[model samples]
Target: MPLAGGAVALVVTLTLWLSNMSRVPYEDALPTVGAVLALVGLAVLALRLVAGGWARAGLMSGVAAVYILYLPVAVFAVSPSAWMRGGLLLMGGVAAVLAARRIPREAPGVLAVNRKINLILVPIVIGIAGVVLLRQIDLERHRPAPDQAFAAFDGEASATSPDVWHLIFDRYGNNATLGGAYGYDNSAFLSALRKRGFAVNEEAFSNYQRTGHSVASTLNASYLDRLSSSAQAADWVPIYRSLTSSQALRFFERQGYETVFAGSWWNPTRRSGLADRNINYRAVPELGRLVLGQSAIGFALAQTGLAYGDGRGDQCRRATYKFEQLRELADEGSRKYVFAHFLVPHPPFVLNADGSCRSLAKATASSRRDNYVAQIEYANREALRLIDAILAGPRPAVIVLHSDEGPWPEPFVGDERFLGRDPVAVDWAGLNARQLAEKMGILMAIRHVDGAPAPAPASPINVYPQIINAYFSGKGVEPAPRHYVFESDAALYRFKDVTRELN
Candidate 1:
């Protein structure tokens, strides 16, 4: 009974944090759990001074116990009907209150058993926390030096610098995958790019299935063979570390060019310590969004205007801000290398086709393919404008535009009914070739100055190397072997190359 509140709180927080280890940071739950446990412990202590031990215990544990009881019913929010979810909330709250009331009157033997359970729980939670902390402590300690493939040239440049803009169209699918899986043709968009002097790849696919692996591979110009194939829970810490301080960025920084990074809501693409200017919008924290914000209580908070993810308003703002920055920076005539990651044409489908933000109500009810195509249309239209503005600028220009990975399968990010469920729950191993392609496909194109042919990579691993070979004077690295690998969400580091299957 003495440890019940704090024990349950720690265990619950630990569960949420562990299941989302790849997405959530190691410290995400520590402070919240500590503050909550302390608050409840102090309340119990104060109440015990004036009241009976049983009364104090029940009062102090009420909120913590409510959340525990609420977990089972949290799945109720998945139903499309709002009334069903609201009813579950009301009934769950009532049940929690009644349980608290009954706790004070429990028999001695029952209270003793409850205390025993808590005794076991508290130690187990602490041990788990201790084991995970050591690995995460040195996540950012690695500062990757330039690869020997890229080491030949001292990073020196700046003759009108031919300002470079690398843009990421998150979840933008390639032509075949868009048409084959979703029945959405993108030929006109490719034709549009051709007119803008871009050599578009109709069959481009990501080298990895997930964003972290794909991005780290692309930015570093190599595969994640360094990561163990049987990587465990804490493995993502280093992936994130490698992502922010990539070998590619180091090479850019050496060229005497200013590095500008614009980020979005997703964690891997959220920030970069190496960039001279990191552009990001005010959005809900990644931990809160991926963990608590997807909960039933988070749904309630959003309904009552207490939550921050309003129609992905911050994503719309961030993406719009990136386009605006591109317009100004392209025209500013400065020597620069800009990496702008736009999380759009992606999920939640909140950004409308006509450059407007859709209401959360409509976004929740949207058909998956229709809204995805809508966002792609919006990206196509705006990108043309940005390209035109850049081409007219005083300095020579280069644009490397591509998607990190393709559209997520509908089961992972459908309407509100599916949004709260974990992507790991989907059977990635069971996916057919087309479905795999749907997830692996991407939009890729490159442009260089003077109407010269851009040397596009077979996959993302060769992207930076090709860029270096075309522009730099020294002997550049050979393109790394191209292979598209997918791993189960359960084992993020384990690899199974599906290159032939996708072909």
Candidate 2:
């Protein structure tokens, strides 16, 4: 009976995990599943040791009855959400399950016969359910190896190295896109970068639309086509998995640099296994919240606003914390390679130019534009302040001020659902040339040590290769052609090269 309960538990939890595989990896929930199984196994073993013959069978039957009634009822009852509410329903279910055992003796012959049949039927029902749920998982499609993805970027470690900082300002558009698409002039910011010994790529774009794929391509020193082709088409698990570790981090580690990762509230970036130190703030990990939302009790609790970890205020605070932390780390005198992905000026329009928080009044294009401008205005001041500090440090540094991807096009600027919506679900053909550039054009600025040549036609994809050749002297590799691939949101893996159309 306990063994039957174990199978039911596995089926329930794994079904939830598989349903949300886009955010949570399959291996993460395995530990919890394993613990449940272990506990059930121990309970059966102890019962066998303590009880003999019919006594053991009766005890096991009771244990099975309680578990059989408990888990599903506890998880799925009383649709509304709260910890107190879910807990009460769970206790009520247990009381009823225990009470039902006694009332069966008082009932008629039909009730006794039905009870016996149910005892036999429950295990078979659970077995069939487990088989049906297991079919959802596809084990053949695995993630690509980082080493193979970064083959062209192979290099031997150099004895002398400068502090490298790859600062990704989320959704910070290039000057061209800012002026042409958003009706905002960003020449002042670009001019400031130029004055600080930085080369701002006048024309730069990301091959992918999403942040996960863009960062993966840049750090792994290959495009998503190279990376995504290795993985199963339309499977986003590989893209998110690349965030935790990358060949870029490994290369710096090999060169005896202490790796530091400061990420946004996104789950994959919150902590990295390969980094020496992680600058994760008080923001809750998204993976935990995602898995919880899949469960019955958790789903009820979520409706009361307890399940969501996101608030516009958190977006403001976390970005501030990251900026402060990055500035502090710059002067720490360690040979550090910091990759800080800050989610600011991206959405929700929560920040003002003077560092004060503001809420959006309405979902209008004008209102969104005003709010977005204010947020980016704040980001600019912060970026300049950070750049000054990094430049003023005792040791020379190489700072790459890049954006993962450009902002949403004019069509989504006023939509509140923009952030939560699956980005690739849109009609790829709907985006105009200007809108396409607005979404894909990014800010790529590099400040190299002692005049390391800037990448020609310096797109984000070309940054690492140029850095390797100039700083690490890895190989004589030509700059990757300025080819861009646009994939339909509906068919994620299908690539359509639109370099000519954009150019």
Candidate 3:
């Protein structure tokens, strides 16, 4: 009986451990394939124990206790969801009582029996095997690989245009915002790109307000409407074992370019576990580490905002990581399409090496300006460093320093004409998830160019198609409509006919 109970415990442990190791979030109420199989093994153990004079009630009760009380607290923390919490507590209590019933009442006999239960070797062996097997499979099959499609395209266009480097400066808005709010002339940025002989898109908007949605759309050259419709929690894992995976490295695969995803951000990569193949995460090892540290701060900041899990940390980290990855991509000497996403000129404004506030509780307009200037200065420095790195590469490259969205707090922007007044603050009780995200500064995209074309009005959604049409179709297809770029408000949506205010 004890042996059988040990086996059930082993199965439960295996399921939890394996699922967590896979980094798959528990949603949809369906256990992963491995977890399901492990449960079956536990059921078999339960049957065996029941046959050998095990108290069914006690064994079941123990199972209930572990699942209800222990599992919920370990993951979700203590909450006032009493009905759910009560259910778990009940199961745990029952399991404890049932477990007690299975042991001999006599203390000595119970001690002897407990000793034997602990000595069971088979279940322990099985548990070890489960951990090793799950981890090994993840290591072997899911790493990043060269994108064949990207490679094919690279071969086809090795000499047409310089190597394309799409550098995302997280959420700096367009020229309008930069010029109006900061009072800095964008002519320097524009002039720099023109000097490098590239056409820049001054009017660009992100199809989605959030970085992951926009970045994914840009990388894939597809629309967010298509991808978001199917993105599930499991899809968020680092590995792409599931069928719904659609983060953009695959597009590069078709083009035959060696694609690398290095960043400090957490994205679908956390779930896809495909870092081994076409989406390497450790591209800029040191920068990746620093970005990760920044992400920790980003996460804490989120707790105070509306979008509970906006993936900013993931996006920020990814941006920094991608910058680091350039060195490796250059070293590989493979025709490459590198997407370097950097989260700068964005906030917490807390990541400064010198550590100072960009704005404070009583910040005046000048103080706000000072804060943003510091951030822009930092972003510009990083941007220059990245461009130098790309130019220093053996091959000629087309580097694009772009932003996903603009700054937040409409008042700091001071352009009542362009940005609307800040959204009304909700009472504490009225606060919902979306409000939090807005406060934290989502939905801003800025573009500062160095080697790319002069700025045009654009969105991230247009980036891929623009690149593909330029490089792949060779004038076969017309450019996507400028207005087709995705934009967002309280509700995230595509900008079918957005107000083109930069004029």
Candidate 4:
């Protein structure tokens, strides 16, 4: 019984841990429930082990039921670590042993077989019904209705434009490094946008930290408080669904832009389905392997989740595929808003064109600097490619290229230095600016591309508003104040000095 209980407990703990790693809430509760249930299950398992009776089959059946339920759920929450998978397999062994022990006490072999069948069938039916309902609800909310054409991105504004390119090179740091390290000034990239008459907003800072938060906020134009509150809700599914159904799509579609989404590897179900057209890195064989591998592993372990090789070595190459993807969209003669989200500078640092990370990862701080510089350079080059394609085509286009948020600080990139931790309440009892900045305003850049960059001290919150105003809403159609400069909480950052450069 103890063994059976332990197995159950182990399964629950793995689920909880995986959920935590995946940033899912309820990490604490699941384990508590599992622990209690495990104890109960364990007692039954133990009795059969000792009595050498029909209890063995019952134990095996229960263990199987627990895993069949737990493993799939874990996959949705987090990628299964090697440990979680092994733990599940181990439970199967425990069940088999308990079942074998029951063979001896059976009054009739037929009756024992029938009981075993019933135990398995009951749980299986319940599980199937639950999964079906959950999936149905998920689809109803997120999936587009058959009558709707993927949020209609090609309305009026898309009518006479050349080609619109929204090149979002994920976290590609700025100009100086691009020029010195990549041996090419990112000016080449900027020059291309300028030639296309894009009045770039050179000083654009992303409103939020991290991709999920940043991207979610960008599309929905909602502040972190709302997003965080949503995240903390009873279910995250609604949050994901809400963002999917944002009014931004309808707005963009009304602007006459045919939006197409392209990315190396991400669950397109979230972003792609919302766009008019979605292309994945899976279209190319080499990139397809990485996409499929991640998907397969994710499917197997129920974990789905990027790599930008660190440094200057192959940053250009890293951006190449995305640039090409954007160019293809531009060539389609559709006034398009192509979201080319490149997964660079993320981690595991393996996808380098120059294969530099092999030697660089072992290097010290200075070497790490060189590696990051290399990545920045590559990012710049890719930016240039997309910009050139747009400039070459005839069109009155506005290019807005910016980071999702700030990079990590120090020996690592985007560390606490960039993202100040949420303050402990007592710490703020008497703290002021110095303390606040230490915990909040990590220097983040919102550098823009064409137009006269908006006065600094801009809010990442208003990025969407600014873009819409610049591209679609026209000058007089001022967005709400919250859109321009919202705070992490629902508070607002007052407009201050416009001349200050991001420190």
Which candidate gets the maximum lDDT versus the true structure? 1
Q: For model 1, how does the per-residue alpha-carbon lDDT over 1-503 read when each residue is reduced to its tens digit? A: 56666666566666666666555654444555566577668866765664367544634464445454345346454666667766766776676666655554455754665666666766887886765564344442331222422233333454534667788887888888788767888898888788777887767788887677788788877777665532353356556655767776787788877888887766666777688888876644455454445445566765665535343665566677778877887777567778877767766566788888766667667776777787888898888888888888877877888998887776665343222232445556567787788888888898877656565557777677666656764356665455555456556666777778877
lDDT of each: 0.67, 0.66, 0.44, 0.43
- Candidate 4 Cα deviation (angstroms), residue 3: 25
Considering summed lDDT, which 10 consecutive residues are worst modelled in model 2?
50-59
Give candidate 1 regions above 4 Å deviation: 1-15, 27-155, 158-160, 290-300, 306-311, 360-366, 408-432
Ranking by TM-score: 2, 1, 4, 3
Number of the top candidate by TM-score?
2
| Candidate 2, 51-151: lDDT as tens digits | 34323333454445344434435555554555665676567557645643443332354244445645775666576556534643453345665665555
Model 4 TM: 0.53
Candidate 2 local distance difference test against the native: 0.66
Candidates, ranked, lDDT: 1, 2, 3, 4
Candidate 1 vs candidate 3, TM-score winner: 1
